[model samples]
Target chain A: MIRITTPLTDDVIKSLKAGDSVLLTGYVYTARDAAHKRLVELIKAGKELPFDIKGQIIYYVGPTPAKEGQPIGSAGPTTSYRMDPYTPALLDKGLKGMIGKGKRSGEVIESIKKNCAVYFAAIGGAAALTAKCVKESTLIAYEDLGAEAIRRLYVEDLPLVVVIDSEGNNYYEIGQREYLSSLK
Target chain B: MREIHVNEIINAVRDLCIEANYYLNEDIKNAFLKSRDEESFKLAKDIMDILIKNAEIAKNENMPMCQDTGMTVVFLEVGQDVHIVGGNLNDAINEGVRRGYIEGYLRKSVVKDPIDRENTKDNTPAVIWTNIIPGDKLKITVVPKGFGSENMSQIKMLKPADGVEGVKDFVLKVVKEAGPNPCPPIIVGVGIGGTFELSAYLAKKALLRPIDKRNENPFYAKLEEELLNLINGLGIGPQGFGGRTTALAVNIETFATHIAGLPVAVNISCHATRHAEKVL
Candidate 1:
């Protein structure tokens, strides 16, 4: 069981490989479909984003509302490919990691190779257990979007599977192909 | 004739919404469980373990099964003998969805318009389908459809001549095209016949059934069996990692349709497959 700290560097990021399970600890952020659109828009305009892009990891999640005595609600990875278009830009800005489910695209794969970034996926829909990883969370921007808001979360040992590595390998696509061909 | 107050209906919808989001239907849960034992690939089995753990955590922790929380989709059956008092039946259902999403801490996933895309704050204005029946009880099925699985769902308009072989081809095509996108090891809900819309409805409805169970119609049941065999044969195991278990089950729901066309809708569900129903 390998555990690593969050907001990882390009060197730390490059060391990881596809299919390795890592428990992510330290600062993490959440974003989903809506935020992706806005982030992309900002990237297109060459404007600054709310948080520093350097060595940051964005969790692809929009958790349920917190109940009594809870820090955050059920939190899990949303599909990753939805943000594929914006990923290369983020990677270029020193973003080292992303957490989501499913496969990524060619451009994003190339970006990972160039930028030494990696992608991880928490079990999709395992929201509550996911919330346990978030030790501290606060809204940094876009609060009006409700769950879609950009928030900084301090996490401790958040579990994830390395789906895409800095070397430009993606588990989802490769795994699916291997699985499909094996049957026939 | 039974006259039900509007408040009662709203309350029923509200309760149903919470129940649906919090709990995974027994059948869907069973499907994931069964897959754990049967999956041949080591990685697929491990992924299944994560899914099962996710479900247990969601339930015991009183969390929404997925963070997407899904767009609210309710298939409502209203009896002809029942007359709603005070307000519109549709209003009651929407309000119930709003209340449930807000009160239950479920995420608000509905968008007002597709192009403009404004958030509906509370997963309101559920995608509701109503059918009038000859009874007093009103059935509300709350289906929270996550984006991943919903995106992978399909509608097939095959020629009437193609028949079951066509369905087999179409279903496999969909699964193949979907790849890892639907979260894999999906439950395939196939609806045959009816019009385009009705067939799609049947497909969504088919997903509510138990995973391994066959359709009551023996002919369709055989299709389910054959399709199940074919889908698993694809080797798109859990999380689309290599495995013997591609689909947990293939459920087929057929309806009477136009003579010239054969429409099939595939409502693909990820391992999460969250749905719950309440008849009141």
Candidate 2:
């Protein structure tokens, strides 16, 4: 598995390919449907975003509340499609990586290629296991959104698979098709 | 008539929510182990191992197995001959959900309004279904339903003439279209017959059954086996990475319906299929 650190650069993203397993470390931010909508709205209104999007990764997750002495609760990826409408805008802002599960839209894939970004998927239901990889968590913005609030996480060796690369290759299609053909 | 205090119901539901979220059911755990053994795809086997390990950590550490601790669904069977003293029924259930979520550190996922979209803060107003039964005991089964799989669930109203073939085709189509989105290695709950709404209800209810069990009807049981095979053939293995165990189980539950309409619903559940039951 390839190990990639956060605050990803174009060189780092362009080197990856779809279907490559990855261990992501460094800083990643959390956002789901609610926070994405607000972020897009801020961009439209010419208001400053809560955090910088340039050279950063946003995980589509709404984690359970952390227990006392724990950094975060069972934190894992949510489905990515719900954030599709707002993704291209964020990608345009120099966002370099996304972490979530499921397929992205054709439009989002095009934006990924155009902006030299990558998409990675953490195991969807492996929340407890994923939480073990998170080293620290801090709430960033949109506190009223509760679980949907933006939280910054410092992670170490969080297991992920490159689902879509900057070159526009897609793993969901490639992985399933190849595996099915091999069986035949 | 036996007097069962509302607090008993409240406490039971509270414990059910906490227990269900923290502990992966034994049937599901065994199903994963069996799938791991039978799985030919190396990647799928690895994914299964991660899930099995996740369950162990959750139980041992008292953490939610998945981050989406889900909206609480209470399938309540209240005894007709018993008296519920001190409080109303629905409030007690919501109170239980509130306490359970707060105490257990489960995520409060429910929003107050669909359009306005504000978090209710305490995951109250659970999706409750109550039935009056003959006995003097209250049976509550709490299923913590995460929306990742719930969003992929589908329902169809087929013409009566379509028959079994139509049902079979629709079921396959839903699972196929869902592909990886519902997190494959899913539990498919099929509800056939009844009205459109009732069909959906039966589909969710079917998920409560253990994966190893099948419909009592021999014909339905055969259909379940057949569907399971076809789903596995789709190559949408664990986490949609591809493998032999696309689905852990296909559970079907049926009720009589209108002569003109054959309603069917498929409720897809992720591998973290969690539910706990208690009798008070």
Candidate 3:
């Protein structure tokens, strides 16, 4: 597995390819459908965003409330496609990576290529295991959104697979097709 | 006549929500263990192993098995002889959901309105289904349904001419299209017959059944076996990496329908199919 950190540089994203396994560390910002919509609205309105988007990775997640002395609870990626509408705009702003489960739309994939970004898949239904990777988390924006609020997270060696890379190659398509064909 | 206090219902549901989210149903855990052993694809087996380990961590640590603790779905089999007291039945259930979500620290996923889109914050107003039965006992089953697989579920309104083949083909199509989205391996819940809405309800209810149990109807039992085999053959595998275990089971529930329409609803639940039940 390749080791990478957040605030990914364009060169680092370009070096990755579909199907490469990654262990992502450092930091990522958490947001989901509601937060993404609001972020896009802020951009359109020419207001300053809550954080710097340059070379940052946004994880599509809405974590549960943390118990006493815990940074976060059951932090895992949500479905990615729900954020598809606002993704191209985020990519245009230099967002280099996205961590979530499931497929991205054709338009979003095109943005990944044009913007030198990558989409990573964290294993779905493995939240407890994934939570082990999150060493620290704090609410950063839209706290009224509750779980949907944007949070900054510090991660260590979080397991992931490159689903779609800067070149626009998709592992979900190629991997499943090859595996299904092999069975025949 | 028997009576149940609303407070009791609230407390029971509160505890049910917590228990269901933390504990992987024994049958589902066993299924994962069995699939891990049976899978041929190394990646698929690896995913299964992770799921098994995740369940253990959730149980031991008192954490939700998945981050999407899910909207609570309460299925109530209330005895006709029992009267609920102290408050409105629905409100009491919602109160239970409120306390459960807050106390358990589960994610509050409910939106106030689909378009307006504000967090309800308490995860109240569970999707409750009530059935009147013949005993003095009330049975409450709480299933916390994560939406990743829920969004992938489908419903079909088939003409009488479509028949069984149509149902089978449509199911396969849904599974094929869902491919990687539902976080396979998944449990396939098929609701056959009934009107449009009832069919969907039956399909959702079918998911609550134990994976090892087969339908009493011989024909449907055979169909379940056939569909399970066909789904696994598709090689969607665990987490859609491809293997011999695309689905853990196919469960079908049927009800009488009108002459003109045959509705089939398929509700898919992912590996974290967390459900708990209690009788009061």
Candidate 4:
């Protein structure tokens, strides 16, 4: 497993390939469907984002509440496709990495290839195991948004897989097709 | 009939909201473990390992299993004799949802509209269904609906003559079309019979059953077994990255329907099928 401590850089993104297992540790941000919408709007209005995206990984998650002394609640990757629209724009701005499950669409794949970025999928439904990697947690912004609020997390060896690499390869699709073909 | 205050119901619902999100019920946990034993693909098995690990971490640390904390879907069985002392029964349920999602640290995924989509700050106005059964105790089932599997769900109104073969084709088609998107190894919940709406409900409810268990009807039980074999044969495996456990299980729930129609609904649930219920 490749261990990466964030803020993710071009080197980190370039190093990953589809199918490579990853353990991302360090500070990263969380966003889901609602926040993704807000982010695109921010890009459209040409306003400053709350955090620097350049070479940073944004995890598609809105976890359960953290109790006293806990770093973060069950933080796992959500489906990545929902953020596809905002991805190209963010990639253009030097964003290099994402963490979530599921496959990317044609447009997102194209953008990923063009911009040279990687998409990692966290294990779906394995919130408990994933939470063990979180070392610390803090609210970055959007507190009123509740779980949708953008929270920063300090993680250690958080497990993931490169679902979409910089070269436009998507393991989820390939994996599925391969399995389907084998059936015949 | 036994009587309980409305506030008690609200508190029960509120607690269920947090409990349902914070923990993975034992039935789901055991299903995955059993699937691991039965899974054929290395990649699929590994992915399932990740899922099992994720669940363990979530439970230990109080983290939600999935980020799509889900739209609040509550199923209520209210006793006819019970009296609600709270402001309103519906309001109590909504209030509980609001507090549970907010305080529990789960996402509020409800949107105001599907089209000109605007989020309703709190995940409120739950999709609640109440059945007035002859009982004094309130029974509530909470399903935190995730979009990955929910998006793949389908309903078909087939001609009665189309029969079992037609159902098989459609079920396979849904899984085939869904491929890796629904986050395999998947669970296909088949609600056969009933009307269009009830079929859909049965499909979702069917998912609550243990992943390794079979339908009670011997005929349908055989169908479930066959369907499981067919789905797993797809090799969509765990998280669609390939493996033998394309689908961990196939659950079928049926009800008597009109003579003219055979409504079949498939509610596909990902490996992380999270659901819980509490009776008070």
Best by DockQ: 2
Q: Give the best candidate by TM-score.
A: 2
The regions of model 3 sitting more than 4 angstroms off are none
Candidate 1 chain A lDDT trough over 10 residues, lowest sum: A175-184
Mark the 10 consecutive residues where model 2 chain A has the least summed lDDT: A175-184
C-alpha lDDT of candidate 3 relative to the true structure: 0.90
Docking class of predicted structure 2? high
lDDT of 4 by residue, B1-280 (tens): 5767777777777788878776777766786787787766566777777777777766765667776678878888888876666478889899889888877877767878889666786789798988898867788888888777888889999999999999999999999877766777777899999998999999988987877678878999999999988887776777777777778789999999998999999999877676778888
> For residues B148-202, what per-residue lDDT tens digits would candidate 1 score against the true structure?
8999888979999998889889999999888777777788888989999989989
Candidate fnat values, all? 0.71, 0.77, 0.72, 0.75
Alpha carbon lDDT at A59, candidate 4: 86
Task: Write the number of the candidate with greater TM-score, choosing between 2 and 3.
Answer: 2
Clashing pairs in 3: B184-B239
The candidate, 1 or 2, that scores higher on lDDT is: 2
lDDT of 4 by residue, A1-184 (tens): 7888787666777888888887777877888777877877898999988888777778888776676787776666777777887888887877777888777779888888898888888877666677777887788888877777888888788878888888888887677676667667
Q: TM-scores across all candidates? A: 0.95, 0.99, 0.97, 0.88
Q: Which regions of candidate 4 deviate over 4 angstroms?
A: A7-14, A45-48, A138-144, A177-184, B79-87, B112-122
Q: How far off is residue B110 in model 2, in Å?
A: 0.6
lDDT of model 4 at position B264:
94
